[model samples]
Target: MNIRADIFSRLSRTDAHLFYLPPCPTPPFHSPPPQKRSPLHSRDKSKEKNVLITGTSLNGIGFESARVIAKHANLVIMTGHNSDRLNLAADTIKRELPSANIRPLILDLSSLDAVRKAAGEVNAFPEPLHVLIHNAAAPIGPFKLTVDNLESQVATDHICPFLFTKLVAPKILSARTEHYTPRVIFVSSIGHGIGTGVNFDTLGRPDPTRYVPMEAYYQAKSANVLTAIELSKRSKGQINAYSLHPGGIYTNIMNPASAPKEAVEGLHKLGLLEADGTPRKDATLKTMGQGAATTLVAAFDPRLDDKSGAYLNDCVAANELIGPPSSDPANAERLWNLTEQIIGETFTF
Candidate 1:
């Protein structure tokens, strides 16, 4: 049996096209050709757009996405918990694109109080936000709880982003005009297909017995998709919301070699890992540029304006790739309500 095809077939609940099967190519898929003048300063200053992205660490896709966004946006707010790393990422982008306007902000997504404080800072930015991308994810490890008393993975990956989104929603809405509509993107993963649906019973619980690191990780990723779906429905065309898998890239966060033994063996069987257990060198994986393309597309593609709430892979819409549980509107609503209840806040459109 072809292990890669077999695995993907099972991962995609439907018989439709497989996620990451088309093989994301290496090239700038969404960014335009460089202009004689910087796109940031070449346009009217008042009309220039602003973008905010989380998890701009040096080794992840978030850094790559922020680098690209800085080329076109008036202000690119790059965020992370480490002030030094955040500043380094912003400096690196500025070095590459001398005209890039970058702001380094500290944001820790694990603590509800910290997220609220950071959102307040973001909401106070001089210009309204045109795009918000929740690209941060928790590293998989042993079961742990956050200061907020929730499971570490779900808190960092889903709940904090939800709170931040609700708090900064006004800034996003304020950017909307007759010609321009703001967008929000959640950087989900193909791992989102791991489970049938969000397990509300165990979600946010700190019981170590109930926690399997990778399963919890996938459940949180699925929450990203559900959140996007619900946010779009509630926004009522005022803002665009999307979720995407940034292809199978060999980033620090996705090194199968360092994953669980079963995960490594599975990747080996699927030809995604070499006999020695390192990632295979082929089209099966994407470069940083290719990996970040779908996120860029979800953020700025005018063609997707009407496709809000859709899940994307390889720079195109791929709702068929997600399982029915992740796509069900009722599940989205359920997760939304539970998240609100847990966070002790209510949001209404």
Candidate 2:
């Protein structure tokens, strides 16, 4: 299953740009000012639109998303906990697109203080931030506490990102114009379907007596969806907030060495990897490019203007069977309140 070849085969049949461009032109809901131009324009105002993506390692979705979005976005900020990998990913993108304006920022999602400092640096950037992609996450073996005294998974996947988003909300809002709406994209997972809902009593700390590694991961993913929903509602359409399940790709998140055997086998059976268990480098499995497709769409798709809070899978709106739990208003609000309490700061939109 040569997935990359298949994608290229499909792309060979049409204008390759079709893969990245929006399906159709979607006019802004509001009329633009006389001199205001759409950010989608290739020249002038388009340079004002900047996008930030976290967790950008060499073969992950964040790196791929940055590569694709950099084709049009004026500036793409690629962030990660590792400085070397972050710079390397940015350099790789630059090699492919010499005109690309990609910058590297250090962001360790497990630490609230680090998130705050990163947000401060982002705020200081000369260009306004038009899009933020929270693409970094990990599934560890045990429930370890972070420096913030919270479960590592939830802290990285939800809490730190929640705080980062809140701190950067003003910058996101300030980037808005009649021609553009700032967007926040959460790179959630289909594992969210396994989650019941957030447990308010044991948010930062799971009950030690009844801890499950996968369950914790699912809960954090669900929290991602709920946070996006609550942020969208709180923003009153002023900002677009979305979460997505990037199609199963054989990335480090699912490395065979660290992941469960069954999980790895399932990925192999799904044609995302080879029999030897390495990610299928060919086009058969969903390539990193394919995994990043939905994130790119959710970030720039104009048709989503009225669909802020929507959960997307496979580059489109996910059905109720896989997406309903994350849509519960009560759960969203509950998580938002609990998050505010955990962070010791209330976010007012």
Candidate 3:
């Protein structure tokens, strides 16, 4: 497929550009080129490092991150809501790397209690955690509330992850050494530019009348950026926290069944999807490996050691394109305080 032509045609036709596809060129799916790894990663012994990743569906970014990190991480914990799928992902990774150490932990980020329980279990583990990757997120779904009565998107995207991070922070801190730097990576989206900003007053209140699925998604993603920024500040160089747009990949997050028929058809009309609705095996859409590049770089790159809290895109710091709103310190502080209030915990640091 002619990716450049398809994106251009789509851009010319659509006035509402809420969906995020990176403008950068992508390699074809069948032969995705290898990405560069951090030199620092080669010096580390896999058995000495511990990593955790959320939302590890078989073909998603999280799963890909785990697959790549497995070669360097001693123990990689992959978490998801379904035990069956998590086990399958673990098996798939094992098939490729026979000696890979990976474990599956069930966690529904939409539920606060589940997040807390999962965090507790992880915290009890003796190993010091060196990496935390919040790669799980939902697409625009029907408006609903969790047991905590908070909007599902915000809860899954921000609230629960925030709580889980707080609960497991001590372990992350303990893992840090002069040679090892603990890292936190949040997989955000360029769609964050579409949000109208966080509304603290109506944050958790579920109002069907006021719910706009795309806006809700955008707000939650924006909160991810804010969370990473604030978390980096609080860590004060002890940990590196970064948020990034993982390029436009055709994962389950972009499932046609969950989108408006017109939008789906529009994407299909462009050469982005096949007749069967899967992403075309062309340069138009990124393969899972391509989408996971920025995340892998953020996790292990030594060059990024002092660039904590930066928003990355296309595998480099991209605060300029993400715009001022994402970097606004005021918004980060506000979101941090609001998250603490909602989670009912104080992270003093």
Candidate 4:
């Protein structure tokens, strides 16, 4: 009766078995340009490839992702809602790598105006943006509405990311060259398979009367996968879009004190947590580096170029685990169109 186990069981035996193993360490992060340099090589010196990531609070996957990416990327823009925490995260990265170029941007995903203003700042930057990581997500909670009157979890997890990506995609597109293509990565979760499917009828406007906290979360995560799939299709090789499940890493978001009491108990029953409430110390429970590994793979792995739209786990493609709801192309389009409807804007690409 374990939904996650059932979902994993549906994967090919090889991939399903790998799910219980740690992700293999990757080589150095950089990808050297192809030997046949083009005129664009002259611009590379001035136009250093930049990476922007959201939700980089302390000790979380986002912060770890920024820290790792800053080691090699020319510029790493870290974002969060609180300036103090965002600045601290960036400073921490700088202290670790003295030469690392870390820019902390304040972003509050609950507000549409804030999303627009943040996207404007990213667009105004002089250099091209080579990678965009949607690492922020709403914490598990009861049904609540944002200032925009959308469900808080869905608004933060899906609507805001959708709008921000729409606005900033042009910057990512402009960075494309013969040897380098911009990448868009969504840090989705295996929880995506918890729900039977997304309920487009009431996605943005969830009925608090019938709200289920974890169900809402799963739906939002599924949207992440659908968004990546549709983006890969629409970009038509112009960009690489990928979504992944960063294994269960115990961050503040998952702390029993911060997460709902019911949710914590459910995780225990599911064997995801130890009796004391910490994440279980198994291959399924990853370190911050291991949790961020899939994101890095999706971001820099040349092997993923032809595997765009892939849903990765344990650093390898595992689309079979996403199930028919998330894998259906028509559903992906429907979700795309519904997202536009929710945001009141259409994205052509």
Lowest lDDT block of 10, candidate 3: 10-19
Error of 1 at 136 (Å): 0.4
lDDT of each: 0.79, 0.75, 0.76, 0.78
Tens digit of per-residue lDDT, candidate 2, span 166-227: 99888889888897889999999887886686667789655666666667777888999998
**Clash count in backbone of candidate 3:** 1
Candidate 3 residues lying further than 4 Å off, grouped into runs, are 1-47, 257-283
For model 1, where is the 10-residue window of minimal lDDT? 10-19
Give one digit per residue, the lDDT tens place, for model 1 in 1-349.
3322332222212211212233333233333332332212111222267989999988678998787677667889999998888898889988988988899989999999999999999988878999999999877777778998899889999999999999999999999999888999999988788776688887756678877766787799899999999999999999999999987777865466445554455456556777556887763676676677678778876767899999998678899999788999999999999999999999777
- lDDT for 235 in candidate 2 is 91
Please give the distance, in angstroms, between residue 57's alpha carbon in candidate 4 and its true position after superposition: 0.7
The predictions' CA RMSDs to the true structure, in order, are 8.2, 7.8, 7.8, 9.1
Query: Model 1 has how many clashing residue pairs?
Result: 0
Candidate 2 Cα RMSD (Å): 7.8
Q: What does candidate 2 score on TM?
A: 0.83
- The C-alpha stretches of model 1 lying farther than 4 A from their native spots are 1-47, 255-271, 274-277, 281-283
Residue 67 in candidate 4 has what lDDT?
78
| Per-model TM against the reference | 0.83, 0.83, 0.82, 0.85
RMSD of 3: 7.8
Candidate 3 local lDDT, 1-349, one digit each (tens): 4442232222212210112333455323333322332111133333457989999988688888888778767899999998889899999989988988888898899888999899999998989898899999855667778889999888999899999999999999998888767999999988777666666666756687888777777788889898899999998888899999887778775667655544345446556676656777773566576677778767776667888998887667878766466678999998898888888899765
